[model samples]
Target chain A: MLDNLQLLFVWAPVMNVQMILDGVFVGAVFALSAYGLALVWGVMNVKNLAQGDFVIMGGYIAYALFHPLHGMGLPTWVIIPILIVVAMAMMFVFGHIVYQLIIKRVIDQDMFTSLLATFGLSLLMQQVINLIFGPEVQIIDSELPILTAFDSFVTIPTVKIVSLVMAMALAVVVVIFMKTSRTGQAIRATAQDPRAARVLGIDTDRVYAFTFSLNAAICGAAGVLVSMIWVIQPFYGIVYSVRSFCDGGGAGQFAGGDRDGVRPRSY
Target chain B: MKFKSLKTMVVSAAVVASVSMAGSAMAKVEGDTITLGSSISLTGKYATNGLHTTRGYDYAIKVINEAGGVKVGGKTYKLAVKYYDDESTPARGAQLAERLIQQDGVEFMLGPYSSGMTKAIAPVSEKFGVPMVEAEGASRSLFTQGYKYLFAVLSTSEQYLSTTIELAAQTTDNPSEIKVAMAFENDPFSLDVREGVVDAAKKYGMKIVIDDKLPADLSDMSATLTKVKALRPDVLIVSGHSKGAATAARQLEEMKVSVPIIGMTHCEAAKIQEKFPKAAQGIMCATQWVEGIPKRDSMFGSASDWNEGFKAEYPSYSSVPYQSAQASAAVLVWKEAFEAANSFDKDAVRDAISAIEMETFYGDIKFSAAGNNIAKPMFMRQIDANGNYNLVVTADDMQFPRKAGY
Candidate 1:
């Protein structure tokens, strides 16, 4: 036991700083996906179990653009932003279709029904993605250099730094849009009380559809950032879903103390 | 109305009964062919390696048939395989194995792609008293259960890193001064590899600076790599599947952690050399078979000759991964056992396999009491700068102190 203690002390200092840096970088990606999940759950009142598959699908979209476009001699700067935009646009349309085909039926049902429906959707999406992408692990080649600091004890990849900044920027933009935009106000009103919002001439259905699409767009952008820095697999979406579910639960607790005092249903 | 309905029901029941009787009369095994069954992961996470394993099985059967299939008791029977897709799920693999035996009436069994799947299917073979020759499952724990019917052609996971440790001890002037850091996935195969390395490290009097368990999905190894950089271990080893290898290679390059010798499992099988050339270079890995090993057999001929034929047949076969070679070798072992036993009876064939020992193109084939290939030795290969594997050490050769590229 004393020998084990000696070994533990030997690794304490360096492990602390290194692990903290690693956690922070990885946590930023988690925060982005979580925020997207919170947005849809807060507004639509439908628990989407396929949230992680959406992120994975978005990552594949970005991969398709980056690998093929780079092969065609397109510049990295030209490819990265285009990849994000294409992923978001594609996911937005996909979200709209999902709402029309499945989410609409479960929108007014009990929470358990929605959960079951979306869980089935998650399974379907995983198989479809596996079929299309061939189940091989893929990582985007950002080709970014590494940056070392603090006498090389702290090493950070430039791609990760870029992803962190992009995540923060997108989060800030979404927060501001929710605070000021008309559609965002309608979404908030519908979440507070769907019947009242409908009586006030707000189309709760349109608000739910738009809110779901916006959530997918946010998750899709996060997926793009993930592809740039980390590895992606067809079946990796469930991990993201579980992480986002935890984050969304925490966010719901914090939002429970809002001025409106509308308690979010816990699943 | 009652008389007409009763007559219709009786007529339908008679028709169904006749169909069942005819189906039962159909022969599962004929005088001309002997059938073996397998549950392969043709479409799932293990799909890529599963394809390689299945192709290996097919090729070996084709070659054996061309050479005049297994001659048993004055009769020659051609070989055929009946397989189902397992989707890389253990439950599904077990179910398919049961179906292959009870429904398809196959006498012999072939192993699945992964240790987990093999663990699931092994009990089914044992319960049915069927002998299975598996080529891919390498977890040492699989053999520890004392199952009589299960046998593996590949070396166990414990031998994966022993050669690297031996080479490191020989190459380093002061063995006691060596610090080794290892991170292995928390799975049966990887845990066995970790045990092997730790045991070997103790034998050589080396210090284990850091030991970590990689998560199930292998999402990140930065924390482990970070400690590795600070400790400045003389050698770094990681044991996992393809995903773990890719994660480590990517993180190592991102962190710029350089050690004198880096050894990892699955570098060749995963095609890490081609996928991440810069990060893969100078990494040593253990492989079951190398292309030009000085071993030959009448069945598959020389290693190079087999490789040449494989490439010609499978034009897209980039590299003869150890999985495919071992899979083919398993079939050859079973064929030889059949001919030696001179009977297709399960008891006779099992006895022949238990006592049999020979050399083949894949490697030497001799099973220990645990039914593992004890005579065969794992080879070590280093990924060169040109994104190609250079066979650094055969079974007996030792190349130590790999040059100063991390």
Candidate 2:
């Protein structure tokens, strides 16, 4: 019994620390993915079931820019910002087109129909990506130096550490934009009470578009970060989608909302 | 005049033999592109296996195409691959098989990482009459299905479980009356593997101490580990997905139990190296393919090139799944057969494929009438401290008849 107690005392904390760190590292990526998903869900009130697919598309974009184009003598770091912008713009157009064609009509319909419809869209998107990319895992170009190691047992990856810093900064920027920018405020107002915002002469349609575009931009950023750390494939979107919902803590809840009651209302 | 006439007659006979050999060579297909289709788990839970296998195929294909593809029947053709994610679901796998056959118009197919998925996709291959070269998953029933279109590159589940048991039974230190315990996930694939282990144990005169199906999604494996510890079996066998496999290993380590774990399919590939790096050491598992197992070159020089290429990719001593590499070789073989048959007709291809003595990456492949390869060999590998598997004993390397018991 005493031996058992000694073993527990020695190993429990070590295991806990490992789990916690893993959770944090995984959770950061989750938070970023969720933020993108939440924006689409919160504003459009139509869950873009294909949100994860868009993330994978962004990763593929980065892969193409890095390789093949490497011969063009463009530095990978310099090309990343341009890739992110292009991914965001492409996804924005994709979302707008998808919403306009199918989701906009079914916004007030049965939730089941919306779910099925978006699911079909997701499948279509997955097939498209598979056709183009051939269902392969494309490796990232970025190589970050290792920051530290504890006798080879606990090594801190330099890329992940940098990603944590970048993620936090990105989060702060998004929060600040939501708090200050007029379009952002209008979108927030619409999310809080669309009927009320509509009465206040703020165009809810435009706000929806702006919110979706913003969500896509965030997703593209998350994809860029992920591409740096792990090999990206066309089907990674589904995993991202699942992890995003996990990090959201609950369905239809906002993790980014502040204490000042500036919460985005979700359907 | 009589001596000159005799010389002319001998020369004519030699020329006739040469013409027959040339005729066979000309029958082999050497098209511009040799299309190989893969229906793999790309999107769902088994994505890791599918992704790695696909990567292996891609890397292998790229290397082959760069070398101007396989030269057979006096022509060179490039390899073009069409692949789809089966989503790790049997239904999806079947659908993908149909799509690959009907839409992609591929000559050969490989993939479906689990046994159930492979079984599901087998019918599609049969229906379209396109030859399929399976990788990773294996079930005895697949070969028993009597389909002419099916050819398995990997060994059957029986071979894997039986090899592990055969290995465990020979442990010198634990030579008490052998008590075997079986813990596996509740799935068709894992169930088939457990059956194989049970059969092996019974055959070897070992007592069944415990046999239980752990839950399919057993995240917390403390209870299972505790039970295993209490049972105190001489040998404990585990089979399932990686998550459960790792959980079992971790819990066992935490409990300070020193029982040797002979693992099943869940611990087969390179992924286990990452999940249970410490526990993986000394844990034995049976597999049809291992990149680490050094073997002599067969009829295929291209197969050796793939081995070199894979070594360059993950120089960190990672275990490359041998079956996927075999599938890449199967693509080359199919090209050879297609050319030999000189027709895309299913029966013609099947006839030609069965007749040819295929020198594949896994070695010489000769199929039985049921389309199952008669010589599908499996290796029993033990993981080293560096998380790489070493082929300690293969079916070929086994000390004949018997060794000291567990």
**What is each predicted model's overall lDDT from 0 to 1?**
0.81, 0.64
Best by DockQ: 1
TM-score of 2: 0.60
- DockQ of structure 1: 0.41
Badly placed stretches (over 4 Å) of model 2 are: A1-44, A50-192, A201-267, B1-114, B172-188, B201-259, B262-279, B291-298, B301-306, B309-319, B335-345, B355-361, B394-406
- Tens-digit lDDT string for candidate 1 (B325-381): 888898898888888989878889888888878888898888888888898888888
- Off by more than 4 A, model 1: A1-17, A251-264, B1-34, B42-48, B62-79, B313-317, B338-344, B394-406
Q: State which candidate has the highest lDDT.
A: 1
Q: Residue by residue across A1-267, what tens digits does model 1's lDDT show?
A: 453344336754655666777787788888877777776787677888899889999999998888788999887767877888889899999999998899989988998998999999988888888788766677887877778877777788878877887777777777667667888678778878889999999998898889888878878988898888778877788888988888875554333324322224555
Model 1 chain B poorest 10 in a row by lDDT: B395-404
Query: lDDT tens digits, residues B318-375, model 2?
Result: 5566645765656655666767887656678778778866556665567777766667
Judged by TM-score, which candidate is best?
A: 1
C-alpha root-mean-square deviation, each candidate: 3.9, 14.0
Worst 10 residues of 2 chain B by lDDT: B397-406
